[model samples]
Target: MSTAGTMLVIGATGTTGSRTTARLAAAGHRVKAASRRAAPVAGAEPVAFDWHDPATHAAALDGVDRVYLIPPLGDSDPAATMLPFLRKARDAGVHRAVLLSSSAIPEGGPAVGAVHQALPGLFGQWAVLRPSWFMQNFTGAHAHARSIRDEGIIRTATGSGRVAFVDAEDIAAVAVRALTDEQAPNTDLVLTGPEALSHDDIAALITEVTGRPVAHHHLSYEQMRDRLAQQLSAEFAAMLAGMDRAIAEGAEDRVTETVQRLTGRPPGTFRALLEREMPVLPSDPAVR
Candidate 1:
């Protein structure tokens, strides 16, 4: 079997973390997943832990050698809350840490970037997964059903701005490799799809595949921010606005071979992902 000392995974129930946990467990590593909920996993131990609750942190850190770190949800100062837990991980003998970050957030700007600044001195091995906007966010989250049923619109500040949007599955695949196979990629990787497409391009793709007319609704940054403020915390609402502003400014329009370099295969194209998810989207009378 395979073992890499002991790997403790935070956010194991989340999108990338869940897949990474399964991959690590399948590789025969001694893996335990930490989350706020105490759900049983097939091949690993699930410990009840919360980023907000420091009391349960150490027990989860017990006997761990490497860690898969995920920053908590909105409103926590990553430097303050996450750094202490990272210090505890080091104290518990963890020498490697893999952090899941965003490409939208620059390496030293906010969120996981702050943790990136602090990891090298604390751990012997480390990599940060800086993935572009997730395709799953459109399909799995609050937007999917709404987008389909109404064939309404995807409102954004990214007007005609092309983004090489990537899949969470692809991100997970790369993260697994980073966690297991490679030397610390010790740098920010701008993960993206093979081709960059504008919001209208995405709408066109949906129209082609599903035969449904979905529109790209462009909004000014402040308008989107004000609308988001009604739904999210001030900080989180601001983050979305910031990311959209980045998209507007052409920060996410990258196309890279990093995925192929790391995984020995090309990143899945947006068309491929869209076709796979075509069933989940609404039907068009023209196609039907």
Candidate 2:
């Protein structure tokens, strides 16, 4: 007998993907948490899944009625890289596919948005999560977090511009709904925090929440690029610094109500997110 709605979560170990996996399983859905490593998850089946390999696609799609598309890393165009996988998912009986995309990158960009473009023709249903820069970027072992904790300074080309900085957990909540429910709007969901806050505001928030003397350290676009180049490739450094430049230009300084509409509750406030995640961040005062 075929399961009517077997949900498959791609990139099951990632931040949002892992949360979605747990949420779906808790709902009593038969979830197949797929990954290249197939890490174990309670109340769900772990299956082998690799975006680059076509031969293993069918194995992951077995009994999968819906899919959460988290594309492989690197700069390759996902529209092309993951198309065959999407096609195979459809052929193997997957109905809907929810894609994780970026808020900074506009629709039809060279990467995730490409998957956003291709999924409609390749599947029965689709939804794209166009979320802003994550709050987790500051709370996790990434550039933002390291800079704040180690240097007591945050460097960015984004001058004093604000961003809505949505939380990945919120993104997962929206994704879980789109995957299991029938009423998800078949379009992009621009998930954001309840309000936008400048990088200065962010530094202030941390100082207030943690009672630490943190500060926003701003730099010119060229200077920021040069500063980051020492840590990453010139090309990669430029790409990341360019995003800061965009934010400086007011590209991502706004709020939206989509999170509430889609997930049926207000998106987590930046303060709320900080409160929940503060205890988890490493206590070392010097980690830059």
In candidate 1, how many Å is residue 247 off? 1.1
Q: What's the TM-score of every candidate structure?
A: 0.91, 0.90
Cα RMSD for candidates in order: 2.7, 3.0
lDDT of each: 0.77, 0.82
| Model 2 TM-score, all chains together | 0.90
How close to the true structure is residue 25 of candidate 1, measured as C-alpha lDDT? Answer: 82
Candidate 1 Cα deviation (angstroms), residue 261? 0.6
Q: Model 2: residues >4 Å from true position, as ranges?
A: 1-4, 226-236, 280-288
* Window of ten residues with lowest summed lDDT in model 2: 279-288
